[model samples]
Target: MPRFAANLSMLYPQHDFLDRFAAAAADGFEAVEYLFPYDYSTQELRARLSDNGLVQALFNAPPGDWAAGERGIASLPGREAEFRDGIHQALEYAAVLGNDRIHVMAGLLPDEALRGKHQAVYQENLAFAAAEAAKAGITVLIEPINTRDMPGFFLNRQDQAHAIREAVGASNLKVQFDFYHCQIVEGDVSTTLRRDFANVGHIQIASVPERHEPNLGELNYANLFNLIDSLGYSGWVGCEYRPKGDTHEGLAWLRQWKAQQA
Candidate 1:
């Protein structure tokens, strides 16, 4: 069976950020992830994980000026220094948290006409981040986000992420496969996983169209989980969804899914 991680940022909005750690543990999640951990001290975050017996699975590097609508600095031509600084911060946190992977978000292109230039910058930034992370035994992940959720997200397709990873040539560089996004951008989740499973660093899931619990979606997560196991994927599958109701109440799928896996 695949190990699961609750996305604290999206999963436990009912509780304060720091308190979500215990809530996830109480509900049976052995691992957890979130958007960014910069707001909290590493010591405090580490204490929460230790107290809850939870493993820090993954987190994204700093996305510049989140309130200013800048999703990430990476891939932005003039923000290379800021991007690198964010990478260093991410690595520092991961080291303290014992996390093994970090997603490098490619910032949105200011204009479609700048695709070529932005692509080059993204590749370079990923290469730099991957190489730096490799020294610490950490994998750097790139995810393909659907434009509907993030309208101008620079990386919007599985092929695009794969190509960038290939061009970067960093052994530790890998794709963060999110089924919800894939279903929106490209419908062949299983086929794509089969072909690129070796290069995948992490996987995430949420219901498509509505982005809710897996049981409420068009995708058959039960089968998909089985396929992932059959494909020999041992990485964490993050529950990156917004609950339609109480977060704990919405976890029936996870509970039932675990029963089925058993």
Candidate 2:
């Protein structure tokens, strides 16, 4: 069975951010992931994970000025220093939290003409991140988010991401494949997964179009989960979806999926 990690940023919205750790654990999640851990101290976050017996599966390196709409700085020219600082900060938190993977978001790019320049910057930044992270025994990740959801997101296609990984040529740098984004950007998700499985370092799931629980989507998660298991993927599959109703009520899918494995 594929291990599932509750995405605390999207799940357990009823509780406070810090409290979501306990809620996810109570619901039988062995691991948890969130967008950023910068808001809380490492000690507080680590205590929550230790207390709940939850593994810190994944979290993002700082995205520049989230309130200012800067999704990430790695792909943005002139922000390289800030981006490097963010990576260092993220690594500090990862060390304390016992996390081995970090996702680096590609910021918005409104200018089509600047694509080449941005791609160059992104690749260079990723190379830098990978080298720094490798020293800490950590892997850096890049995710391709759908344009509809994040209109200007730099990375959008699976092939594009893999190509960037190849160009970067960093062994510890890999793709963070999200099914929701894959389905939105490229319809043939399973085929893409199979083709890009070797370069994939992490996985995530959500319903198509609505980004709800996995069971409600156009995608048949059962088959996907089985495929992942068959591929011998042992990494955590992040449940990165918002609940349509109560979070606990929406978890019937997870419960059912786990039961099937039993």
Candidate 3:
């Protein structure tokens, strides 16, 4: 069965940061994920999760500093120090949470001036991160966020993520493919996912155009989910979307879909 994990950060923006996890559990999500978990202490996060029997699915490592327009510069020329530090923080958090998948923000790959050097740095960093993550029995995920949705973000293609995985050559590194961004940057969701499913460790969804809950936009999410099920993908399908209304209202679509599936 394709189990759904709610991205608590997106689903319950109105709630306090720590409370979002419990809210998702109450909303019937067996697993919960988010963009950043750095604000809360690891002990507090784990306690909140245990109290609700919630599984921690996926989350990104720190992105240097979001305030300075620095998303992630893992492949940058002079930011390797900052990138490594961010990765350490993520490893600490993931280890404490008992979660295995840590989404690595690829940041913007350097421009053509030193593109070759940038690629080299990315591969080297991946090798080190993969080994460290493997030691913790954690899988590191490299996601390709759409540049249009998030300008200056590097690693914007599924193929790019695949290349990074190959370079790392580790069993613990995989792609965190997002449907909403992919649909905006590239259509044919089914074919794209099917072609790169082997590299994919996590999946996410949202309606196109508005980036809201599924079933209200261009992507035929039910069919997409069905395709994922049919393909025997046994991974978390994250509800990573901006709710058109409150979190509860957005959840009706998911609940109704579950009843139909039942």
Q: TM-scores for all candidates? A: 0.99, 0.99, 0.95
Q: Which tens-of-lDDT digit does each residue in 99-131 have in candidate 3?
A: 889887777653656667877887777777788
**Candidate order, TM-score descending:** 2, 1, 3
The segments of candidate 2 whose C-alpha lies over 4 angstroms from its true place after superposition are none
Of the pair 2 and 3, which is ahead by lDDT?
2
Displacement of residue 164 (Cα, Å) in model 1 is 0.6
Candidate 3: clashing residue pairs, number: 2
Q: Write the per-residue lDDT of candidate 1 for residues 1-262, one digit (tens) a residue.
A: 9899999999889799999999999999999999999999999999999999999999999999999999887889989998999999999999999999999899888899999999888988998999899999999999999999999999988888899999999999999999999999999899998889899999999998899999987999888988999999888999999999999999999899888767
Model 1 lDDT, residue 47, Cα: 100
Specify the poorest-scoring 10-residue window by lDDT in model 3: 106-115
Cα-lDDT of candidate 2? 0.95
Model 2 per-residue lDDT tens digits across residues 138-212: 999999999998888999999999999999999999998899999999999999999999999999999998999
Q: Which candidate is the best by lDDT?
A: 2
* Models, CA RMSD each: 0.7, 0.6, 1.4
Give lDDT per model, in order. Answer: 0.94, 0.95, 0.84
